[model samples]
Target: MKTCKEKALEWGISDRSVNNMCKTGKIPGVMKEKGVWKIPDDASRPVDKRVTSGKYIKRELQEEIKPLPIGISDYVRAQSEYYYVDKTLLIKEFLDQKPLVSLFTRPRRFGKTLNMDMLRVFFEISEENTAKYFVDKKIWRCGAEYRAHQGKYPVIFLTFKDVKFDTWEATLDKIRGLLQEEYGRHRELLTSDRLVEYEKEYFLKILNGNAGEVELTASLERLSKMLCTYYNRAPIIIIDEYDTPIQEGYSKDFYEEIIGFMRNFFSGAFKDNKNLSYGFLTGILRIAQESIFSGLNNLTVNSVMDEEYDNYFGFTETEVQALLEYYKVSEKKKELREWYDGYLFGNEDIYNPWSVINYISRGCIPQAYWVNTGKNEILEDVLKIATDDITEKLYSLLQGEKVVARIDQNVVYRSIAEDPANIYSLLLVAGYLKTPKKELQMDGSYLCEVSIPNREIAAVYKTEILSHLLQIGAITRTTANKIAESLFANDHSKLQKAIGEYMDKSISFYDAGAEGFYHGLVLGLIALMDNQYKITSNRESGDGRYDISMFPREARYPGIIMELKWQKDMDIESLDVLADEALDQIDDRRYDADMKNDGMKDILKFGIAFSGKRVSVKTNR
Candidate 1:
């Protein structure tokens, strides 16, 4: 029998992992004595999926699908070991146009980082024989025009997706670690006769992770220059999720420090750096000008709304159909489309590849896979501090309705709070919202009609954003229960009194002049009955929009409709008349026509009028 350490060394897994496996009884015939494990001499080496490595192989892997490549974004391993969708044509398309600097922004989990890694493998002059991984891929058939560029250039690939530090100091340390790893790859530069002694010293400092802040900031540009001199070719720079640090900083109260550092770092590396042949960046949002890309005029941004390169990020309908067919679940295509295939990128309908893959891998059971994979803390943070106007629009979106807004593809993080439109713009880039119909204006701007993408995203809004609204609006369980009790009993007076008390307590709700504030509050109150009623908002059944409507899912309970009005120029005495006017409008407009058409009997309609903290509610049979 061999000890645990011996078994770990033989199997090439960590000792801790081997110990854990032994403790969990995964390893057969293992004996423990005096705190040491004795593993069997002939024990098989169980598969180690934690790390990827082999003798004399940096990225080589055996072809199999036993351990599925769920989150493996590395092109080398994914191509060799997993069921890979051929997105290699993305390389051909990118090379065909060959923009000087390209920024492709898509929502998270749309294969942005994986594509960036593919570009690195294809372009970087490495000894991994990366071309062999793409032998049967689509890019291989694009002829010599594209094939000639493979393994031809020096490449600098960096992903800043994990630089989420609380302080600028920790952020710098994280960046230094990444730089050190990169610099270690080119450590032969220290012995190169062409480089000066001081340059060698600077490179050594970088590899040791002891470089000064200034040295680290200029590290990329310096590395590119060094690589150009070594390889006699300008390096292709690819940065993945480049805006992650800035986004985190803005949400975490260190925006200025990060932006200042990144602006200088990017300007030095990208602006007028002769060592750069071309650069590619992938991020969730294209941060606005005068921030990161200051004075860089040669940059080209291709957002989700852009027609060019739209098919490169997400899975197209045909691609998803083929994927389902390959898995022999072709009959489930419709179900998949309804849940995950509503993302409209330009004119093509796209599916969330991450969610679809997980769904298939998990026996074709549908789930909110994409939404649950990561924390939507950034979005929730922004919404918690949202003004009344933004909250109302968000409520409309939650109700499965569209809103027209001027979408700025470029999102400025610093101004996101002050500018309400920035919230919509950020959500658009982050995949929380999608534009169905977009019109280009004469002034080079876009007027977008945006809404929630699909049921999955709407589920996220309901769980995360709506729950936050409930908390911010101070609609507690007691309050929600009280409101529901009043609605079920059709007690308009008690409901009005309860709502007026709530409005009085919330200073922001009372002070908000936007009509949506009152509308959203009523909707939020009704949302508490989501378990008991099929609540809907702004459904067009009559001549005009009805503010709120609730139909009990079971026929035994009564259906309810509500119309809300804001008394703009009225005293306390005028509220009753305004409330009566609301009731008259609800009947005159026939707002309950759809509910009645659905065979809903004994519908309860309520007209609610609001003037600041005073609420007047009237119900009719």
Candidate 2:
């Protein structure tokens, strides 16, 4: 027999993939012995459904479909070699607006880098007549008025998307390296007669990576001036993922240092610099409150809430439909929409381009493809300061309910912990929540109703968000699994024991006396059963509202209803009576009516009481 690791190596797949295949019976003669998967040595790799089902096989003479650009951010290569979506119209929009300096704030992996590169390829003077890249695109048909600007100016492009470091010193070094590379791109400046000896000396210093922090901070302004002097036209500057280093600083305990450096650095490049023709920046958050763009009055900010360039950053429904049609998988459109669609960028309904590409590339198996792309630090930060009210609202959102919130476009990372309400603002910009309805407030904020975007985000919430909350209390995974097993088995005694153990270990005495606390605790734990049950809380059933309800998604699993009660200074006997009272309340109010109406025959009603750290659970099995 061979282990899963051996099979993974032979199949050129991950070990986890091999184990999952065994668990799902995708491979024959696989067995688990002592928690280790054993597979037959001669077992063949499973045939991919996309290949065998004739979905990708051509029976007659037909053009083969081009590969999707999964993570390609290089515009020249992506447009030439892959199934490039026509985003060249972004150039037309920019030419029409002609903003002096534009900052686009979008979530990660939404084609920010690619769009920026597209702009770079369009405007930057190249010897290869880069206009050919856009000749077949939508922008080319817009007439020569837009095409006249192609390859007209020198462009200074730098992407800080990968400059993630744990220390200010290392971050500075990475920045220096990036500047050195940008300087290397414009090597003509070293020999240009337009630049004086002193300017060339500074240029050489930056190009050779021997520049200090002061020189590096002044690098953009210097390079733009030299390029302008040589080309007799002001240079355009593009910075991709500009806030990556800033986010790293905030998370890595070097916020002030990075913020201070960025202030001077951005000021030199953009603030009152006549050498700059047009500047562009893209990041997840605006970070305006950090003073990074201070005193740049000419700067125009286009966020997800803005209507000017909404559809440019992400894939629209039409683009996705066309892509699906081209791939001959138009039937998967509904499933793709459920998993990857539902993002609202202004009035345009957008889908995550990254996840959509990944879904199609991976045989249309729907999962949280976008969630795995980056760390969900924004959600983690929000959960750390979550109040009881915030917790309840989050639980409601997880259960597919909408809640109203005020979204401030200028929200910063440092201010998130000070005001928990800013969590919604962060969540919206970071693409965790979507605003279906919004009204502009007088203070430049939006009063919006926000909810989880789609099924993929709901799954991410139940797993990442809930798991992080449990981890904060040092709760073991075994404890969670035990609770889920006990509840599913209808073993009220085991469930009661599990609840008591969790409360005893995780809850503080000061936090246990409130009924709302217990409600939140139980709701968080029950949220883990999302795969099997459609979890709901504080929803009206038949006659009244139930505290928590688990309507099983399948008829095989029993429906669950939990009624919680808490009182201060209650002894064990009083707690027991309170538990029974809770059970009576559930029955009297007919909280199980909705479950019964839905044809759920096996219902387990749990009445849970709490006083201080003690818990009593009584159930009508």
Candidate 3:
């Protein structure tokens, strides 16, 4: 029989992690005395018998990697009725040994904070009150020994996401408040009787918001040691959003100062404490060692390239189908698979578990939906950093050619200047773009051109931004329109790149299809034109169909009808073909059919063909 302490060594997991598993009945262990818990016999038995046996009582929930309305303490148990894929097995594999002291990583929404939360819920025991609420979930049904390990180890969980302090003092105070709050809850579990006076005064000083860094570090150390003494167990620690402070604080010196505190603070917790069991951490970026995690070692990083645990935090295909079946959303199986199911978390193809569940919960099939779960602060910086390269790509779009390149999904947050070869990689990794398909090449690269996909983003890029011309702060929308028209009528060549760059800067630029590209160019061209008329879509063109209609200032005679063509898809004579098509569409749909009604006579039309950077604009006879 191995004591709980010994199993921590054998498994190399944080004490809190092991404790959670044991509490949830995922591991085999038992309580022999009031203070002693032991794991006797076969330790491989699962907490959830159905999951371990490759069968689910609620057959449809095997895909729900994440379950139920989160943070609702009342709904603690893993709801077997809701879809939840077993990630414990995946995590058990990911943490085959002790993790590195610190790790920074970038994953899509489903991959970031949620994974960290899972780590926190699994590892920490000091806050067992929170864990107590989850004891009845599906995963805790049969593993009796696990239930025995409850209330054993001490754990600390801190998240950098909520940090909004502007000064070092403020930041330290915030951390102190958090630590004190946790300390206040488990003061009874601390057995540092020898340092009783020191700990009490430290807690008081922190409560008063006047704790010094030296004293703060010392207090945290005391808490760690006390937890060790009372529980007769080592401390386990997990941090969520570790890189948030550094990222949100970028270009600001306050960030580095705060980083200095956290770096030293965490190093002491994990390094100075010999009774420390293990640690697990998650954040968007792996800050360079020169700055973030200065002296800490012994961290085994599990990142995008680390494929061993790819399936640990994401939704798998099988899981998706199972969930659909469980929720009786089977009808949406194919649609969900196509839209939100294309992410890859290693070699395993994964889906957006969040989107899938949201759709199921709201009883709606997948659509453009709630992709805005994350704030675009970092995304804005990425855009500002990518102005030049993004501009070039926008120019390429005008040629009706979707830019293609090799991409490393993590390079979006990379510390390097924008490079031409890395654009696609940066975009795809940043979640602003995605690869619809991959074509492998003999040269050890992928022939993939990443692009935006969804009605919401589509409307954003082409509709709103395109409908108006950009302006300086002092320039009103009307004045901006005047300047834009003047710029267009005078010089379109320079204005083309200007609009491309502007669109890239201001919009969620898409890999516009042929029709989309043509409309984008038309909009750019119009931005430099006047704002005298409404920019309407599909007016009197057959039964509700027209690519676009640009009305000019005042009541003009014949409004312009700009027909379009992608010559490469057709032939060199396609211009003539488009010209003929425009004549027919214009006449049949009566494009000028309402000119008389509008107190106008003539009808203006243009046929445009775009190919590999050159645009041929011709007018109707």
Candidate 4:
């Protein structure tokens, strides 16, 4: 009997939050009011029994999960594990198995270190430990099975993530420092007969100025042997982002030295340490697998291509919905999906938690939010290697082909345009894109098209240059009005000419006569400007295709319709005939189908002609 607004208070949040939750596909609801709240006939959300751990939002803190005192760390901790995301559980499951070595390969910042830290907290035992900290979580509740195994193994975690090496010497110094720390921690086992062969050969050099490659390597071997001796079993070897140092290390002038030195250093500990436990090495690129890990035959590599635990990293649809409901930010779902919900990874329907969390926190889906946080080093790499064809295709994708196979994982540079999986991977990892859902292709391979995931990312490409309007410094209030005036002309040619000139100068010099380029340019122009900017789809006739389209995001600005021509083949009467032709399609193709639902009918005419690089614009009253 209650209205949507009245019922909203009972749900513990506002109407807007409920609506957004529905849109994000988080909490289910129906839109009863056009611009107001959705009246949820039933509010019970079904629990998701899928791969994600929590049915609701992911809570990061818990009281019983001990405040780990093992590291030189900061105290501004997150809510101590009230609920963990799927990635956390996956890592836990993997380590629970105690594999010899496991490597997690993801692009930068997919929570590699944080997940590593969770493993460090649970597995790595403290000497003066208490049984008090592990009680609240279910891991402890696994009862006698879990507790009996507690503190049973010595864990040695080496994090190369924070290590910065501008020079090979710096890298060597860091490695030596780590060795010294490890040796001091395991001094008792270092005295064992099995490991004693390394004290004179390895430690003597740390005391002296000269350390050989063999001695440095022998020290790691000695350490692994020591870990086995102390724990009475092999250690849990977890190496987080182990390959990052190599990637960053070589960008400097010392590539060969660092790689060669690192290869030898790691080969000792990783190349089958006799007294060793299993090990894990993670990094960005595989880094020539044969070159580093050498004979560590047990090493299992998990990159984006491997579908074993595809749902392990990114958020799933149910999780996304639950988070929206949890945060009460569900009112922004339609806005959220339009920008971010488009990437697909294998069979798992996942979303980027990083971007969505950021958007929901702000209460508005920003355009191109991911771009600001992403690394453009690959972008630089892409531009350098992009041939003319690749450049044109990127421009083509802008027009909405939902391109397949535009990227290849193996060929980082050349692969970006032909491999659909790799294209989304590059875009998602780079933060220039996101995974919205899982789409099963006819060919049996799933594909995720790159979309401007969230407003946090979409607002980047706006200019009269792209739409063909000349500007002074930036797109100001005056320029925006003038462009609106141009659109009001309803002359597709005028709008087309405007965009043609803009793209030729600002976008790319070689896109002349490229229909895909212009179509995308128009879409870019409409998407840019204030949300009120208008573009009427399929305006009018002889004007072909439906005439012109207008998008008015605000109430104050009048809509614009435009018709574009590749050449000047018509006189004024001919223009009218063409315009009439396009106007007819408006009704046939339902051009104004949705726009009319908003009640807007101010129409003008414009014809734009493009001749090579020349843009001739004309309008009719």
The TM-score leader among the candidates is 2
* Collision count for each candidate, in order: 0, 0, 24, 98
Worst 10 residues of 2 by lDDT: 55-64
lDDT of 2 by residue, 497-615 (tens): 77656655555533544777777777676456666767788889777898988887767677889998889878989989999999998889999998788877888888888888777
Off by over 4 Å in 2: 1-63, 483-505, 508-513, 539-546, 569-571, 588-601
The 10-residue segment of model 4 with minimum total lDDT is 67-76
Give the TM-score comparing model 2 with the true structure, all chains together.
0.86
Best by the lDDT measure = 2
Inter-residue clash pairs, candidate 1 = none
Per-residue CA lDDT of candidate 3, range 1-621, in tens?
A: 655544543343334545556677666456556665667644753434344433654442343233443322111233222334555443344344446354535454554555555555655564335443234332334355444444455776666667665566666667777776766666564345645666667656765657778777665566667677667877767676766665545544476676677667766776646767766677655554434445556765655434667776557888887777756768877777656765554467777666666777776655554355544444334334444345445433322235666654334243434454555554454444445556666754467765553333332333223333342121235444543654545433443334334433332233324555455445454333433344444456544466556555455323556555554444436645664665566556666545446665544555555543334455552
lDDT of 2: 0.86
Of 1 and 4, the candidate ahead on lDDT is 1
RMSD after Cα superposition, model 3: 13.6
TM-scores for every predicted model: 0.80, 0.86, 0.58, 0.60
| Error at 97, model 4, angstroms | 5.7
The model with the greater lDDT, 1 or 2, is 2
Report every candidate's CA lDDT.
0.78, 0.86, 0.52, 0.52
Runs with alpha carbons beyond 4 Å of true place in candidate 1: 1-68, 385-389, 478-516, 526-547, 551-557, 565-599, 607-620
Tens digit per residue, CA lDDT, model 4, 1-621: 233434433443344544455666665555546555454545553343556556333432131222212221211122231223434345446646766667776655445665665565556566755233343334555557666655566676777876667887777777667666655655555456655565545654653436655566566666666667656687766677776566556455666676787678777777767766566666656654336667767777666556655666656777777767665668877677766665444455556555666666566646454545534555444444444344444433443334343333333323445543344445544444444443556654445445444434434323212333333222334434545555565444554455434433433333355543344334445534444454433234332354355556555544555555553434545545554554443445554444556686654444444444444445433
